[model samples]
Target: MLWTHKILWIATLVSAFAFLGMTVDSLHRMSASTHADQLSAQVIEGKRVWQHYDCNDCHTILGIGAYYAPDVTKSYSQRGAPWLRKFLENPAAMYPSGRQMPNFHLSSAQIDSLVAYLGWVSRIDTNGWPPSPEGVTPAEDAQRAAGGELAGSKIYLAQGCNACHTIQGSGGTIAPDLTHVGSRRNKSWILAQINDPRRINAQSVMPSFAQLPESAKQQLVDYLDSLK
Candidate 1:
């Protein structure tokens, strides 16, 4: 009985020490992994703003904070500076529907700093963390909210269309919002725009999707068309 008790104590102590060592090692590597050297004055100020406004109460960063809002660690990379600027300028216009983000009334300078801080945060080597489930199924839940997944929707996301266009109350705002594009444009017109934006507008910066397989392009057109 004494020997058995001794073995249990040893196992418990070994497990506890191993956990402590891991925690320490993770802390030691945090600075290097997060690129502490890249934290600029603007980024530091942005962090101050984040704390001052208590953003963590709603949003999460680095997978830490509340679940009330979305994680913003990769927002800068996914949405880009242009998108973030417009959204910060007016949260309602960017997203007016359900589970809205409260306007923080952020100043231009503050907005700039926040974007910079988020950009820096996006670069942190999280080592494939958070297991980006959205990439695998872009229209998984969100698209279902709109109306079950469309094959074309997958292509649309794969082509990064959301980066420049807003649809279903989400995505970027650099270009036209495609939330109701079906009402404004016909399927043929949509296909033409995708095939070659320059053909419609000489100065259009949208790249052509003509390189995509014909079937895939058709599916994307269908997805865009279904938005109405």
Candidate 2:
């Protein structure tokens, strides 16, 4: 009975020491601020909005949350503020692919705050957590540098095409995979569809790109055409 008690005490002490060591290591690692002084008043408000909306329910930030949606940790870096604002304003219009991101119908002020919060979140060092930019290709980079197709690629990103469409194994799967759309559709048909998707398919949900600059539209067409 005495030996048994001694064994139990030793086991409890070992567990306690292990737990303490882990806690101390975690604290030491966290000594440097992940967010630091980047959180401003606007950022704080934005975070409040994010929490109030429970965005973490659908999207993961800093590797925390449900895996149903994309990680938003580096959204500011990937999409930029303009695209983010537009997306926040009308998520359905941005990507009619199929994964429905309900429109929150946020006010301009709320949108600003949300973007600010995301911007701040983007500044945190996660030690290369996400690891790479999504949907980007070496060929696309080369085309972009050459200035025609790349310009269209920029327009695609600016317009938030990835929200609905997947490209080269990246982006959402709500809509048709556009990895090789160029091979399936000609430039004229693609342009016509972008200008008025309803002309081709009565049930198409794609919004018109007629408002975009002609150059941007043409560049986008060229980019899509080059996808083959």
Candidate 3:
């Protein structure tokens, strides 16, 4: 019985040591590849800005924070720097939707830092989390190729449609996915909704775009119609 007990203790010690060694090695490897290891001065400052502004109050980073806004882990990649800059500069104008984001009135320097920080976050390997597939349909691509000129695409971003509508698997979840809006609604109906969503749905929270120029409205409608 004494010998059996000794053998059992030896086995337990061996297993514990193996587990400890593996754990230490894994931690060491992860630490070497951590975001901190690649952070630049600008990115670090941008992180500070993010915290200073308490953006986490509304948005989430790396699966942390309130669900009031969309996850920003890959926002830099999803929304290009130009669009991000415009949105940050004037959230109200960009969204104009019912749930409009308040403008921070951030200066150019602050905007640069925030964008830089987000860019850094976008590069991190998140193990394929928050799956955001490029939802561009083939028809949409063909339309874009045939003299679409991206005018509508720009207008869509400028109007902050993504704030309430999901396109290509990104943006807020409050509204329906618009990846194939053209297939769901006719162009005239879409135009009507844009002009005044309340006219279509009495309970809709979408704000009116009646102030937009006639040509701009047409361009936006055309762009949306291209989404198959």
Candidate 4:
């Protein structure tokens, strides 16, 4: 009878250990899933801040939107932190010819968060939408293939520039109407202003076009010029 009691106790102990092991396994899986969800939420939140402020109106993400402004997907990698912070604080002082972005007066914390968000986006894969401009003798050839002056319009949509600058009586009203910018500014002037925007105005808010290729430059110029 004593031996029977010992066997029953041993069985109970084994069952308890098995249950504990299963519980631990389940808990680990749950924790892993939760972590994945949290990461996804972070990405979504960053995108939220972008859309909430209508960033798409001036900047282009991957290649799915308008291109009124610069392609910010690569800003984090190409631009330094100081330039990003300074520009975020005062864009108008940097580019004057066609100032757009308003003074959000964001705090340092906000700027940091925005920069973090931009950094996140800059890392996402884009399957090469804007092919490299290398090997092309004539920039115009690439421009024609990329849609010429229409390329600028496409960039405008992707960059969200239309949110501030107007074209053909459409888009936001905060900035000047660019429906006729092609006619007003010389091509060289536009190129110079875009390449190194700070040269135009120290207080200009327009973000500089850092990664725009020389070939795409001519296409954008042609597009802007065609606007007239």
The digit string of per-residue lDDT tens for model 2 on 16-120 reads 999999999977766464655667899989999999988999999998998878889988977778668867988867766567788888999999999999998
Ranked by lDDT, the better of candidates 2 and 4 is 2
What is the C-alpha local distance difference test score of each model? 0.80, 0.83, 0.81, 0.69
lDDT per residue (tens digit) for residues 27-73 in model 1? 89998999998999999998898889998999999899999987989
Candidate 2: worst-modelled 10 consecutive residues by lDDT: 29-38
User: After superposing candidate 1, which stretches have Cα over 4 Å from the reference?
Assistant: 1-14, 134-228
User: Where is model 3 more than 4 Å wrong at Cα?
Assistant: 1-27, 31-37, 132-228
- Please name the candidate that would achieve the greatest lDDT relative to the true structure: 2
Q: How many clashing residue pairs are found in candidate 4?
A: 36
Candidate 2: lDDT of 105?
85
RMSD of 2: 5.8
- Writing each residue's lDDT as its tens digit, candidate 4 over 1-228 gives 699999999999999999999999977776554343344544556566668778887777776566787778777765545557767887764443364777778777667767767766666555565566555456666666566555666565554466567888888776678898978998888888777767978765567665666776677777777777
Rate residue 98 of model 4 by lDDT: 60
Comparison by lDDT, 1 against 2, better one: 2
lDDT of 1: 0.80
